[model samples]
Target: MRVLVIGGTGFIGQHLVACLVRAGHAVHVPTRRYQKGRNLLVFPTLTLFEADVHDDAVLERLLSETDAVVNLVGVLHSKPGRPYGIEFERAHVELPRRIAAACRKIGVRRLLHVSALGADAQGPSGYQRSKAAGEEAVRAEFSTYSEGALTIFRPSVVFGREDNFMNLFARLARWLPVIPLAGAGARLQPVYVRDVAAAMANALENSQTYGKTYTVAGVSQYTLAELARLAAKWSGRPRPVLPVPHFVGYAQALLFEFLPGRPLMSRDNLDSLKVDNVSDEAMAPELGVVPTPLESVAPSYLRGGKPDRGPVH
Candidate 1:
């Protein structure tokens, strides 16, 4: 299979590209920027296509040479120039809209999309709502294409050596004596990166999974506070977890959203946390892929973990 992976330069995208190539698929990773050399290099089976995916002409041309498309584009944070609509809606919703249209135009049928676990089409937060909208577009437009060929996988917070969630927290825990908390009671099922890549690879290879939406999560669930404790312990910081009330957290989010750097926590993220980031029981038997536990994979990338298998050496 010839697979065109959008957002292949990203964290999960990197893993997914490798997985697809290992599975005997010819992979093409398209990027917008053309740096002389990148920090991470693509595999031999992987080809690089340099173009802005948001550009309809470019994406359409790229689709011409591919049999299937896997969309891995998403952003958790928004900035002045890059709003949620551009980051999430365009990448999530509108890109799918265009992809579906292009696929129809080019006669490319198969597609596998990565959607977050808590996505709700009618939800309040921009992130969830946009993801849900994207899924909706794919189902409505591409479900019947080539007789029901489209697979959507909703995953919880994916953790691995290169994950942003755990890595950022670990970096913070390393320097800070105390960590601020928002929505401490919020729960998350931290799935592994390789597991997600495997799921994507499986979906792309198996035609039986088409037109199905699968929810993937870790073996166990943990609250935000518990996640903090685990991060502190794993990162070897053991800092005090400072609980910030909802109001306070929101206030801080408001300020940080406008700040130069990425916000540690944003109001939209807090709102997203209001909903549990775990798989629903209904989706359990439907998809039928048992998720790998965080405990099994955390040490592989945790700070001061087993030698040659963690964030630190």
Candidate 2:
């Protein structure tokens, strides 16, 4: 299989590309800059495609050469809008729409789209609402196809060595004396990045996952505060988490929004946390994926690794 993974240079995309290569599938990964995806050259079956995917002609040209497509393009923050932010509408809603329609036009039968687990039309955050709209757009475009033609995976907070979620907390624990938190009671079942990547890679050819909306999550659920404490403990920085009121957190996020490049926590992020991300569905039976717990992989990275900020939400 020759696979085209849009947003293939990012965290989950990198993992998915590697997985596809190991599975003996040739992969095409596009990036605005050639050097951004250069590390992927280590994978024998992977090709780095340098071009702007937002361009219609370029996207069509890229899709024309692939057997299937996986759309993992998403943005954590965007300029505010009615239903969602401008970036969210573009990355989450419009990009998927374009990919699905183009794939159909190019005679591509398989598409795997990654959406957020808590995505809802009526959700609190623009990210959630935009993600929901993206899914609808894909389904509407591929409506004429059979069930397995378009598969969507809604994964909860993804965490791994390079993730921003737990690693952010670990970084805070390392530098700050006490962590002031918002949405401290928010519930989340974080899926490992590897598991999330594997589920999407495996779903590409699985008949059971075709046309299905799956909730990909971990084996255990944790509250934001509890997870913070655990991150602190694992990172060897024991610190108390100060749980503030929602208003306080929102106020803090508002302030963060003004601080520049990728706010520590945006107002929309707090809105997202308002909804619990726990899923009752299991990926093992659905996508043949076995979820990895946070305890198993988090400690290794948190204790000794540098807490670099990652772009994956």
Question: Given candidate 1, what's the lDDT at residue 205?
Answer: 62
TM-scores of the candidates in the order shown: 0.90, 0.95
Query: Tens-digit lDDT track for model 2 on 1-313?
Result: 9999998998899888878888889999999899888878888888896788999899999989999999999889877787998899999999999999888788889999999999899999999999999999999999965532988989999888878888899899988999999899999999898888888878888888887888889999999999999999999998999999999998988888898688888889888999899988767575767888888888878897643223212
Each model's number of backbone clashes?
Answer: 0, 1
Candidate 1 weakest lDDT stretch, 10 residues? 304-313
Question: Cα deviation of 76 in candidate 2 (Å)?
Answer: 0.7
Over all chains combined, what TM-score does candidate 2 have?
0.95
C-alpha lDDT of all candidate models, in order: 0.77, 0.87
268, model 2: CA deviation in Å?
A: 0.3
Work out how many backbone clashes candidate 1 has.
0
Top-scoring candidate (lDDT): 2
CA deviation > 4 Å runs, candidate 1: 36-42, 79-86, 143-148, 280-290, 304-313
